[model samples]
Target chain A: MFKALSVREPQPACADVEALSETPVETLLELIDKAQQPPWVGMRAASCLIQGHADAVQDTLVDWVQQEDSRGFAILVLNQIDTLPQPVAIAVATQALAGPYASDATSRIAKSTNPALLALVP
Target chain B: MFRLPFALVALILLPGCELLTGLLNGGSGMLETRTSSVQSQDGIATIDVDVSGESAFQLTATSGQLLAVEAVNAPDGSQPLYWDDWSGVNSLTSAVWLEGKDTVLNWPVRQADGNLSDGTWTVDVAVVDDQGYYTDDQVDVVLKLKDDSDLSTGTVNARIVYADGLKQDSVVTAGVQDAVTRWAEIWAPYGINLETSYEDSSFSTDQPFPGEGSEQAEVSSGANGSEITVLITETIDGSTDYYGIAGGIPGTLDYTDHALVIVSWLTNAGGDGEFSDDDIRLFGETLAHEVGHYMGLFHPVETTFDYWDALDDTDDCGGQSACESALGDNLMFPYPVCDWTSCTPQDQLTSQQAGVNQRYTGTL
Candidate 1:
């Protein structure tokens, strides 16, 4: 994952994100915490976690959504997810409606392909 | 030592002298454009351009073959200039040698003293490869000249392409349109008006950056005519880290994949993942900067500090602090100079820089 994220070209670096979906939830969380370079690794890691271990990292994702620093990455993860669980979808829509990032929330909701998340968007 | 065939003659004449003089003396800064087509026989085509007292002049040559501006001759047929003249080491020796189908030659040609190489200029175009000239290649050469009545104004159109579902209508205040408005204001000082139109793309939210994959080329498939294409996507190359990238240094206006300017949605959001006033400002700068590259302007000085662009007005200040203080305000400076609090405004363009931008084939 480190090697993959370190590469400058985004195609390979981002392709590695899909492979990391099989990685352990704890390992993925650790990688996200330590990821810095390329500036998008944390967001990609969050995406990987959401894709493979949504139930396991659900609370952590919710917590990230509420925080200012990590909220963008968390929202980006939600934006890419093919299927958002009912609870996570409700939590994100509520937080998005009542935050400094309401515009970002609206943009994400408008572009989301997931019907459940789209239905939840106000 | 090569003489241009007499068949080549000036297709367009200069505007009236009084109006031109008034233009130089702060009158209406309208732009005059002349376009002519020549058929290459035995791999070479030549044309002549007549110049008067225009404030600035730029010539663009486009063909389907690998193209190069073989030579240029002054009106009096003296002091002929050739492709080999530019070493590209300094302002005086540098030139815009675009390798693809489209190429441009801005007048003045690196003269720091601002000497315009005006009046009956002869230009030679030829098909060539790394090995040698390709004589059998026959193609149509389209030459365009943009003559600015004054240094104060010019205009170029932009075609904005949005990835699937990312299209923000003209009324959308917070997204691409707002940033484009800021982009226009940044160029207003140079008298370059960036007129714009919008389109929708069938591509997904996350696609390859320009030159990364075929998607960008596909996105640009709809591009036609002289307007530049700007593609807005959620993430380029599956990552939101990149601010934007241009397909070429002086990207072509003809409809080809290599002629694209792309921006990332998340990268435009800046660090906060939300569009603040500062982020919007940065977004606007990025759009202008990237399009500046597409229009053939290099960084006044690269991030390395040792290298510099081919312009006289821009200083060659080396090291971090000196470069930051000297060139941080220029539009084409590499990377924004920012602290934890704020970033410096990069909105200035030297006369030569603006000349190059206006010289682009797309800058109508």
Candidate 2:
């Protein structure tokens, strides 16, 4: 009359995106650039960038938009471009539209109500 | 590169599209279900499950106290089975023993011959007390069986819920629909058809995904009848990184508070506004994977590598490399096997796995 118990593994803990909010903008960018980090880490880092470092990360975001590997995360950041300052949003979208992801960039820009960003679409 | 051939091979191995076509044409529909109350006599409950020319048979026992399968004797009084005894070794007679209120047994699990041995089989059940001893208790068991003589065809209804205006967002809606189509294809081989519908809602939750809370309770309560409700949210608890999670193994088709499945739109989209081809494939696999859990399929080998499912066909492969090599393409692998470039499609379901899905009480 031996009984066996069923055992299941718990899911791994998700990376703490909130913790990265306090990280330096440079460190967040570095984290995003690290190929070893899981895609989520780069995504969380991009969120941290948009929250407070949009102006500083504009160039880097545009660079990621051009690259194949990081384009998805960069596009993710642009999805919330409305949260950034008007000037920074335009700057990033302009550079993004010039990249290989032009169509994707155009769609994200077209959704914006900002006149400056929409004018750049056509 | 290396990903293309694997993808092509997976495509070649997929069952004919006719399975889905037949379902759309109104072939064998959802399996019918019957629930019966079994009272314990001297700490054991004897119940009879009549196959009666059915394609398959599944018995799920639930009680206020924990329940376990103590014996299963066929019509000939042979193959006396014990719970979790020689499990994964004795595939035909091995039973799954879970220390919970509910346990389901699907006949012909992992049996290569697919012989259901139709007859009125007697299953003896017993309750385990708080201290893990056999105790007398009344148990309610539900039997899900396919109709008449159809062995390989069954339908599952899915109601996908869009939260935070995701359904209104055309990009998200198209991506989700594409994923659902792919999910149907993945299950086509097992003759399991996914009849999908969509819903729109706004649910705000601050808790992490899979955490039990009022918000999840409210979402799960939306499920009724035989459809499994899948709720797609913006990002679980403010992060867009985690994949989807199921409320429980075998989430109910009833109007209970714990009968929901959850997927994150942003995570499935890889945080992008639009989903790429790879994103769609991953999303489809995620949908199938999570729904598999809701239908009572466990990961062949858990992430810990030590714990394994109760199935005989799934190997107890250890370590990341070993498990990936062994069960990477399995539909219920713990996570997607991928590196810098692409992921291997996790679309394959073993016979036992398919049996488990078909045996789910919600299949109706």
Interface RMSD for every prediction, one decimal?
6.4, 8.2
- iRMS of candidate 2, Å: 8.2
The RMSD (Cα, Å) of candidate 2 is 12.1
lDDT of each: 0.61, 0.64
C-alpha DockQ for predicted model 1: 0.13
Most lDDT-accurate candidate: 2
* DockQ for the candidates, in order: 0.13, 0.13
lDDT of 2 at B219: 69
The number of the candidate with the highest TM-score is 2
- How far residue B301's Cα lies from its native spot in candidate 2, in Å, is 2.8
Clashes (candidate 2): 0
What proportion of the real contacts between chains A and B does each prediction keep?
0.09, 0.18
TM-score of 1: 0.64
* Location of the lowest summed lDDT over 10 successive residues in candidate 1 chain B: B17-26
Question: For model 2, how does the per-residue alpha-carbon lDDT over B1-364 read when each residue is reduced to its tens digit?
Answer: 0100010000001122111111112245445556667777776778777666655555667778766567777777775466545343222321234345655565544334255566777877766676666677877766655453544567788889888556777878998999999999999999898998888877752235553546766666665456788888766655554557775565554344455777776666653446788778878988998899877777887666776776777887888789989998998887766653466788998887887787654553
* Per-residue alpha-carbon lDDT of candidate 1 for residues B1-364, written as tens digits (9 for 90 to 100): 2322211100222242111111111123333445556666666666566766554444555565556666766777664557655434442212224354555455544334254456677666665543444443433323333444444456777888887766653222255777888999999888788888888767776766555666766667676455678888777665554657786665655445565888876656632365667667767888899898887777787655677776777898888689889987887877666543456788888888887775554554
